[model samples]
Target: MAPSLVAVDQLTVDVITDNVSDTYASKPPFAVSELANIMQAGAQEISGTTLLVANLGYGLRLTTRQGSKEHVLLFDTGTEGAAFLRNCRNLALDLGTVEEVAITHGHWDHMGALEAAVGAIVARRGQGNVTVNVNPGMFNERGVLLQNGTIFPAARVPTPAQLEAWGARVSNDGDARLLLDGHFYYSGEIPRVTSFETGREDHLCRRDNSEEWRPDPYLMDERMLVVNVRDLGLIVFSACSHAGIVNVCTEVRRLFPDIPIHAVMAACISAA
Candidate 1:
């Protein structure tokens, strides 16, 4: 059965870090660009210092409201600390209010600034005040195959113990459950069922230093964060969509067949 979810009156997604920062492009009424956000945060003029840094990574600050109550969650933390921290500062976000964090996958691009972020949060909220959600499968060392046929290992995400040591209450269990008073649905292992949406063959991983590198194209550890908004429906947030957005949406559909999917916010790659 689908887990019970609280219907939020509104949802706001703040893009703290991403691959691009195109503020001049046309956007929907419900959408705001980087420049607008910076200016709204009291930027006098649009300059290098005033603008948010764009990096080869992704991160989002999700804020949801249900009547008078509000909840905030962090999804991923981008590829590094400097860029992520700079962007957050430019946006004037108060990480202290963040109640939980949900890492979409094990990729460094999605979790590189995790320690820095947790430090910021814990600095204001105090030790062990925030919860970071993750699964055990994501702790393995991952790499990519280069064109020359050599493996280029990626930076590993911090261990659960490291996160705990850094003042975050790490939830390392692999279970689909409601989070932050049911305002968000943190999915478990996403099932891959799409035909053409096969994962990247260059991806590889090793359980430990003793284990040999093996193909890890399908990142089963990848999960999606879903928010049920009042009158609108589900707003799914997939970090890299390494599990394939189709499979991600399919799993959401299967989970809540009665709810309509309002939108999917993520970095989508074309299968074709």
Candidate 2:
């Protein structure tokens, strides 16, 4: 059965990490720019240090409010710990308020800073206060084959044990479920049905160090996040869309056939 998603009155998405910092880009009335957020956070001078770091990764701090209640959750952790933490500090984000951390996939760029992020949350919220949502398929060794026939291995995300030791209650389940009291829906695994929306052709992965690199083009482990906003419909957040954005939206529509999709946030293309 589809989960009964709760409607939130408002949602705020802070781009904690991304590949670009578009301070001058024209945005909707509901959106804010990097410079505005930084200055609001008390930046006197707009230097390289005061600005948020742009990297080859993605992360978002999602906050939702319904009536008198508000919930905070993390969608991803970006590529590195220092940059992720630095952005958090620069934006004056309170990691302590994060009730849950849902990783969109096992890619290093998304889960690279798992340890540091969880540690920061645990330091403020205390042990076992936050839950880290993940799935089993995200723990494999991944890489990409180069033109010269050599495989460039990507850094593996922190193990489940590492997350537990860092004071996180890891919900390592593979099935779709509601998160943070139904304010968010963490998908199980995206089904690829689009003909032209094929996945990455160079992706490779293996179970362990001894296993040979096998084709992982589909990235079957990738998942997406969804939120139902009051009067606005659905807001979908697909971190990298290795499963394809069309397929992601298809899944969303299938799950909530009556709800109109308000918007979709995805790192579908890399400009860097």
Candidate 3:
């Protein structure tokens, strides 16, 4: 049987922390890209010192609406806490409105600001315990292997305890599930199914801080977020597709054969 559509009336994704943006370019349809951002922000002050900063990471603020009700979901936290918060403030994002957060993977570039982001959410909401989705496999120590057989460690991400201290209610599981009142679907551990798409092969990881390092090419812990729009079909958010963007889209299609993928966000080939 086909799964029922988790339909949403509207969806808007703000690229909170990406590697690039066309803010300075004279974008078509929207005259003066700078003014477009400023006008869209309303009363929020937009200035050179307070402009959004692009980082060598990926993050997004996804807002979905159905009639009067709205849901906000934070996908990934970017590479650095200062940059992530700075971008959020520049965009005038209300962290309290973020009902759920899905950390796409454990790589620092995607989750370095998890703690600070969760704390900001809690601070604005006047409480702790903001739910966050994660996979246990991503918590292991990871690194990249050099030609000399020595492994250079990757940036460390927050642990369950650290995230908890910052008011995050961690859900570290391996199964796929719905989020944001079923408006979004957080995928389970992705199954590598493509012939041409493998994974980042040089990435090495150890299950423990002092364990023997092994080839952790596939990054099995990474997950994707999917939202089915009213007319556009499925929109998938795959941050730093270490699993290959094609494989990610294929998996989404396999899960919801009826919902044609309309768009993909943060789909990138990770060299690190």
Candidate 4:
């Protein structure tokens, strides 16, 4: 049967179990069976709200209620191993059916399994079948050095050529063209309407031994996935929110002022 697109959620986070001395040394501890039970229980709690849970821990996969024949927008692929693949299999999800993989930044953890993930998708769909939309040169364009002198550049920033070679397309506008109808929309570059998010400093990227920090209004970190549900306002799924959550909410309000913010899930909190 042709797979119909459906919104579903599943648990993607995994409990680290292998090679940890602490976990391995415990009495009857690190039991895969026990851990699986606990994970299953936790998964049940959030299952109702999840559209499609991809294992961001390694790679990504998508599954829906109807069956495992749904498509997914993978954010990042985990490092090599059967861990990610096995997780998908356990969830009855197929990595070969990913519709898009959006790499939030150039961080190793985020894009580690990018090639593998793409290969899986290609194995299902013929060569040059899928499009991977990425922000063009976003990593090379900007960054910031924290007050503690720690530098944070744009992570996982892949060039257009690099993405194309992997059977994907790239865009810097942060707008991803939709392949399936009724998919969630992305709230592109957010507008800082409130004073709560202003005066953020940009990290310096040194090319020729010269260092400089400046005010970056663009704050390239401002991006989110917005889902406009019937009565639920806007549901936003965020990666590392370099731009404060408030800033992201404000931008959502600007574009969709009438919509209420139903929920927000993010990986990092902005120090700004």
Candidate 5:
């Protein structure tokens, strides 16, 4: 069955080359042609039900859909990530038409260009309102482990109020008030549905001034955008599936038992 709604887009990743020159000293500088070649070399694309995964160098953009509404959820905006933003703008995909913006797991790479996304939406839609969903506590109190097991300070998590101050409606915690349909249908706490799904043990966050580090667990962070099409079945969109893909699938199945999963799109792999 064809879904009543469509999340149209693709994920593309590009490799950036930094050249070390006196003028561009921070990292490295590369000629426009060289950069273009690097970008062409590292590009990858994937398509699924509710997500259009695109890898723009340091970060990823998961464009989701629900009925006729569309939202572009960003994961890791990247540090000094203007190039990625520009790439998004230039892509065949239209960022101007997005309905909302969500930040997945606070980190500079994930949240840096949030303002840019808002601005682009404004430029395209003109003074329109949008929702920004995030779990600020993920960063406000904990740290995360990199691929090498090296611990890094958690990125400053932004509150819904903070995002609201910047003209966005932030959806924090497990609040479902901002949903277009106002239907709280997802199954309770993921990770509990499957044994393969396990939270990250090395990820920790600090609550007080003390040096104590608490496991991030990325609890509420497992949330994803689910779209139920009249005919096309179900589409699930994810940022970083820290909660485990199997668990996420289980939750989706539990929520919409009759809706077959037509596609699954994600950014990073918690457990493949």
Candidate 6:
């Protein structure tokens, strides 16, 4: 079946997890607590110390409302269930409303809280079908080889069966598609076409348990999400753009030449 191309009426993004934090809210937008007050979330905890602690991971809770229909998509879980779940609770977010989960890559920091998130969703859904936007390339062991020739093992992500057991309908594919009635555009395997856009160095992976790590710079499983807002044009969500942010943006332009990219929500930019 073909994916939908309809633009959403409104898009609201909540950074569920990320490496950098701005709880101080010294700028135009105050902290989540103050924002909650503006949002009328009085029941939630609002304290100086109750704010969420930033982690070396990325997760975004996005809600796109088109007319009367509203949908939620969890883009990548944080380092672990504990941190992400805690933040969700503190924020008083309704995980039950999430219908889809999109993973960006196979790194542990990006997918560690997947099981906990699925469990929460199923608990609220009560046998509900939550579609997980994923690809088969993420189900293997991955690592980074340091300059010392030592392999830094990464925490393995949940297997397909494990995700299914946690009540997830895995949508593993190689081509891009739209989710929630075209509210989101999920990119397939990103091609490394840029000459200067070099990928992560020392990125290695092992297929079998006994196999050794090999150079796997372009993580074939890495994908991105694009939400076309009514007036905002396109909001590209590239969490851990291992394939290169420039390449990701270029693809967006190629796909939608008519629309202008108003904003780009990228993650894991500390190294850069």
Candidate 2 — worst ten consecutive residues by lDDT sum? 263-272
For 125-188, candidate 6 gives per-residue lDDT tens digits of 8654798878888977988899998998888889888888888888888788888888889998
Task: Note the residue pairs that clash in candidate 1.
Answer: none
- True-structure RMSD, every candidate: 1.3, 1.9, 2.6, 8.8, 9.8, 2.7
Model 4, 144-210: lDDT tens per residue? 6677777666444445676668776545456543333435454445555556655345444322225
Q: What TM-scores do the predictions have?
A: 0.97, 0.96, 0.91, 0.62, 0.63, 0.91
Q: For candidate 3, give the lDDT.
A: 0.81
After superposing all C-alphas onto the true structure, candidate 5 shows an RMSD in angstroms of 9.8
Runs with alpha carbons beyond 4 Å of true place in candidate 6: 1-3, 25-40, 43-49, 269-272
Per-residue lDDT of candidate 3, residues 1-116 (tens digit): 12644689999877778887667665546233533554566635656655777778888888999888788999998888898887777667788898788999889988988877
- Which portions of model 5 miss their true places by more than 4 Å? 1-81, 92-94, 123-128, 145-151, 181-191, 208-211
lDDT of 2 by residue, 1-272 (tens): 24479999999999998988887678888888898898999889989999999898899999999998899999999989999999998899999999999998889999987788998999999999999999999999999999899999999888889999899999999999998778998998888888887777789999999999999998888889999999999999987888888888899999999999999998663111
lDDT of 1 by residue, 127-240 (tens): 989999999999999999999999999988899999999999999999888998899999988888889788989999999889999999888898899999999999989877
lDDT of each: 0.90, 0.89, 0.81, 0.50, 0.51, 0.81
User: Taking the candidates one at a time, how many backbone clashes does each contain?
Assistant: 0, 0, 0, 18, 19, 0
lDDT: the better of candidates 1 and 3:
1
Location of the lowest summed lDDT over 10 successive residues in candidate 4? 15-24
Q: What's the lDDT for residue 156 in model 1? A: 83
lDDT of 2 at 171: 94
Model 2, residue 221: what's the lDDT? 85
